[model samples]
Target: MKVDASAGGSSQERSAAKASDPTSADAADDAGAKPRAALQDELEKLDERLKKLYEPIEKIFEEKLKPGLAKLPTQAQIDAARAREGEAARAREAEPSRADLQPSRTTAQP
Candidate 1:
């Protein structure tokens, strides 16, 4: 907040100044719009800059990520792999290995 200088400045002097100039009211109204117009232009420029920042990320997702995602395995293939691994584990658990039947004794010679 500012204290307007009262020295040599009064309402009577201000009213007389406004009375002498008819266009001052219109100029005041235009002064208000100048800041709004400048603010609107600044907002538009910021919007354009923000959109430019996202363009490269959007392009990368479309060109690189989408194709790599398509090449990945489907749900059905992943489930089938589960069954194959479970069957191999069962076979290994049920059978005794030939290496287990032939015992080898090795002595480390230091």
Candidate 2:
């Protein structure tokens, strides 16, 4: 088998060219980087705009809703509500009805 030196030398030259061609690699890097940078810049601009737009609305909600919500039922009010429920239950039991209070036979047993 005859080995071709010229063919082998050309392959070595190709490898050296690939290794040394920084401009081509840098161009490729730049091509990939440009769109990513553009997207990042757009996202940052959108985030800043969103923050600016929401700030006043957030402040308004905090100022308006918080105070009104604070005025609603504390723990004491909740205990009073439970007490009222118990009183209502006792009143219903004590009250008399014209109709029979017994469950019908057609209903399923508990």
Candidate 3:
């Protein structure tokens, strides 16, 4: 196969000439800038959409969940309940055994 080096060289020269031309560079920049601007506009729109989507959820948390959470028992309430349970347990332990309440089977019958 015959390789045409001159054709490749001419194409490289054309590319270099295109790059060196200010008008061609400006056109290229304009071409790239359009898509970049569109992408940036799309990103800004998506950001607004995301904010809109999360706003209701954030409001629900603030209005409903926060108040519900606030109504829940505090650490002090939990500690008080635990103290009452402990006291009840101690009272149960202090009470007489079942055997103490029952009559002795070893007692003689008349």
Candidate 4:
């Protein structure tokens, strides 16, 4: 049965319509209860499973990898190395082009 959208009635009207419709009422009731609980339980299980799966990876990064990475050059050292490389690149660009050193060939008149 079609609902009166213009009436602006309470939700009771919608529920009443649903109650009268045996197929819809049963479907609505089923949707409201067991499936929702089951979905929540499934989500909780998945969350726990994901946590369990990542625990070892987290531990490896925290315990094994972090210390090794900590021993590497500090940020200041890295910035200094980058600055030296940039200076070298600028010096190379400032040098005279090799083509400028070559002798020019003059065209002969016929």
Best by lDDT: 3
Error of 2 at 66 (Å): 1.3
Q: What is the per-residue lDDT of model 4 for residues 1-110, given as tens digits with 9 covering 90 to 100?
A: 77663246778877666666656856568666987899999999999999999999999999999999999999999999999999999998999878777766676769
Give the whole-model CA lDDT for all candidates, comma-separated: 0.83, 0.80, 0.86, 0.84
Candidate 1 structure quality by residue, lDDT tens digits, 27-58: 56756588889999999999999999999999
The RMSD of every model to the true structure, in order and in angstroms, is 9.6, 12.4, 6.5, 11.6
Better lDDT candidate (1, 2)? 1
Looking at candidate 2, what is the lDDT of residue 81?
100
Which is the winner by TM-score between candidate 1 and candidate 2?
2
Report clash pairs, candidate 3.
Answer: none
Mind sharing the TM-score for model 2?
Answer: 0.46
lDDT of candidate model 1 versus the reference: 0.83
**Error of model 1, residue 85, in angstroms:** 0.7
Worst 10-residue lDDT window, candidate 4: 1-10
lDDT of 3 at 49: 99
Candidate 4 has a TM-score of: 0.46
- Against the true structure, whose TM-score is highest? 3
Residue 95's lDDT in candidate 4: 91
- Pairs of colliding residues, candidate 2: none
Q: Could you estimate the TM-score for every candidate?
A: 0.38, 0.46, 0.47, 0.46
Candidate ranking under lDDT, highest first, comes to 3, 4, 1, 2
Off by over 4 Å in 1: 1-40, 74-80, 95-110
lDDT of 2: 0.80
